[model samples]
Target chain A: MPAGDAFTPDQLYDIERAVRYAEETSGLHFSVYVGGADSETRPFAIELLNELDDPDRTVLVYVDPAGRRLEIVIGELAKRQLSDSSAGLAALTMQTSFATGDLTGGLVTGVQQLGTHAHQPPMLHANDEAHKL
Target chain B: MIVELSGHSLLVFVGIPVLVIAVLTLLVFASSIANGPRYRPGLSWWAPPVWINGPTATKPDPANLPELPELTASTQAPGATATATGVARTLGGASASW
Candidate 1:
């Protein structure tokens, strides 16, 4: 890893895998940002969220290690699938890990939980010709 | 009378034990050393920001992000900037601190 990089190659791989899992499970874009905020953490997080290709369908996880803050910003459409309460549950999980200085573990678990909460089960009968008729 | 210590006896008693302790210490710390620095609460962060699965288009610097305008009931559509578009109105999630 570079001197200025936050995670090692293996660690980054884990996070990216979790992100992929979340996207597949929830059918939504997932993004993660790890750094310090220029201003207040919440609005900065919102700003980061808006920077995505599909902001309305993206879930942005912003973690400020130096500030010891974590913000989970879900877009309008995504909010329907992932409730604020569910986001809170994930935040709580991340918070516990962060408090113990486990950034990678927290992010992996929290993103996974978010994806699971927003998971949409397949409709068994929807694909049937009889149902289409 | 007390026996005087010889050079070989000193090496066996002291040098071997010191070597064993040094090896043991290295073994205990090897993993963390390889892993590099870790994030600790309230400490100054060292690395640059990392964005995974972020926008394909290059984004403006966070430090230079335009000042957010006052939120209104009217929701603006997401444009290129999407900066002025108020997330407070539609954004929902959670906040936490350690």
Candidate 2:
């Protein structure tokens, strides 16, 4: 790890893997941002969410370590699948980890939880013909 | 009463113990040293902002973004609306602070 780097390569790998898993499971684009905010954290996070290619179906996790703030911004389409309550639960999980100075842990666990909560199970036979009598 | 401390005794009691303590201290701090600085709440952050799976991997200057139209009910459409800047009118999620 470099002197000012926020995460070691291994830690970054873990976080990326967790994000990938979340995206794969939930079928929603997942993004993570960690650092200081130039302005208010919420608006900063919203700006980040707007930067995504598919903002309507993306989830942006913004962490302002210096400000001790965490903002999980869900896109318009994503909100339907991942409700505010579920996001709140995930936020609680992250808050616990972050309070202990474990940024990576918080991100990984929170993302995983979000993915799980947002997961939509395949509806089998929905498109199939009726069964023979 | 004056007690004479032999060189051999000094090596066993002082030198060896100091060496052991030094090794233990290194072992305890080695992980943190390798990891560089860890994040502590309310402390100034050192690393540049990171955006994984964003529009660009590098952080963009907030000032560089074109000013967006102020969000207002009159500006909104019938149902869901996204501004020309792609800022969504409906946003859902939770906020927390440690």
Candidate 3:
């Protein structure tokens, strides 16, 4: 890892890959922020989510390892697709891995879970009504 | 008679053991030394910001969205009824049931 970077290249790569998978599976924006929060975690996470272009459709995962805090915030629209319970489940998975200091593994697994939970099957019937001969 | 040890004997007694110990230490720690330091909690982080789907990522930026209208405090009256449906329902009003 470079002097200013928090994660090694390999670690960053793994995290990025996990984010990609999460987005692909969920069709929602996924953003991860790992750092110390100046204030309360949940509010801070909400602030971060609001900074995005589309907070309503974005899911922000904030981890404060130093403070041992993990927050998963789903925006208004995102909450419709990913319920709070599902987010809590993902948080539990990440929390366990984080407690063990397996950040990469935890993130990969948690994000994968979120993606799976939010997965939507393609609608194949929209244009089929008029096509049946 | 006083006996003096030769330099070769001194080398075998001290130098070889030191060399063996050095090699053993290197063997024990070679992986860690190569991989560098591991992260410990509460320590200062050293990495830069990495945005996986950020502007730097290859994915195209989402099209610009229409700007939202600003809501000022004056626009919303105080003590208005807030509904659980996330809609504002009229409060302090009498209604006839159908």
Candidate 4:
């Protein structure tokens, strides 16, 4: 736990657990990056998303503690699944937590919301082929 | 000549060393206290990427992904292409389609 490291082991665990839960519920790829960005936060986040193999299907959460900024960038396909408004709401939730130095709590709640918003119910009529005939 | 060795004098001697010890103790730990929590950058990240309900195997590097077969005109369907799904779509207005 040295200074400038992304997060302490415990902090990382909590964030990862939250991510896991979000991914499970939403069925979307979730990535979290906590560090300072050399450029504008939004574009920097987009760059990070591009670094991933499937940028169009990934949701990346970027936090810049020193700059006191946060960005949640949803990829093209991800944006369709998770709207900007939904992401904004989650951002508000996380902003409150981060302001109070409660990064872990904020992330957990926000990620859960993302997951819930993206949850898709199973299609029950897929196997009813006889009706078509 | 009258000499006084009172309780006040004895208390001073004892209190002075206690204050000195407390100050010294604080000085020893002051650096750690001021530094707060810290993390090193560029090293292996603390936790592995957690992918819930994701592929059971480790996430493959993008560079390592096998090349996909190129779709050529010979194999392409007429006026149809693979559609990307799983993304939510928002429909505007009350337009009905048959």
Best by lDDT: 1
For model 4, the stretches where C-alpha displacement exceeds 4 angstroms are A1-6, A131-133, B1-98
Per-residue lDDT of A71 in model 3: 81
* Model 4: CAPRI class: incorrect
Each model's TM-score?
0.82, 0.82, 0.69, 0.59
Q: For candidate 3, lDDT tens digit of each residue in B1-98? A: 98788999889998999999999999999975654555455555554444455333243332454444544556555733322223332221110100
Report the candidate with higher TM-score, 3 versus 4.
Answer: 3
Chain A TM-score vs. truth, each candidate: 0.92, 0.94, 0.91, 0.89
* TM-score: the better of candidates 1 and 4: 1
* Candidate 4 residue lDDT tens string, A1-133: 3334444567667778888888887777887776667798766766666556566677777766656677876765676678777877788887777767665677778778777876777777777987565
Q: Write the per-residue lDDT of candidate 2 for residues A27-89, one digit (tens) a residue.
A: 999999998898999888887887788888999999988889999999889998999999999
Instruction: Considering the two chains of model 2, state its CAPRI-style docking category.
Output: medium
Q: What is the DockQ of each candidate?
A: 0.54, 0.50, 0.14, 0.07
True contacts kept of each: 0.82, 0.74, 0.18, 0.04
Among these predicted structures, which one has the highest DockQ?
A: 1
Residue pairs with colliding backbones in model 4 are A2-B38, A2-B39, A3-B38, A3-B39, A5-B39, A5-B40
Interface RMSD of 1: 2.5
lDDT of each: 0.88, 0.87, 0.67, 0.62
lDDT at A62, model 1? 97
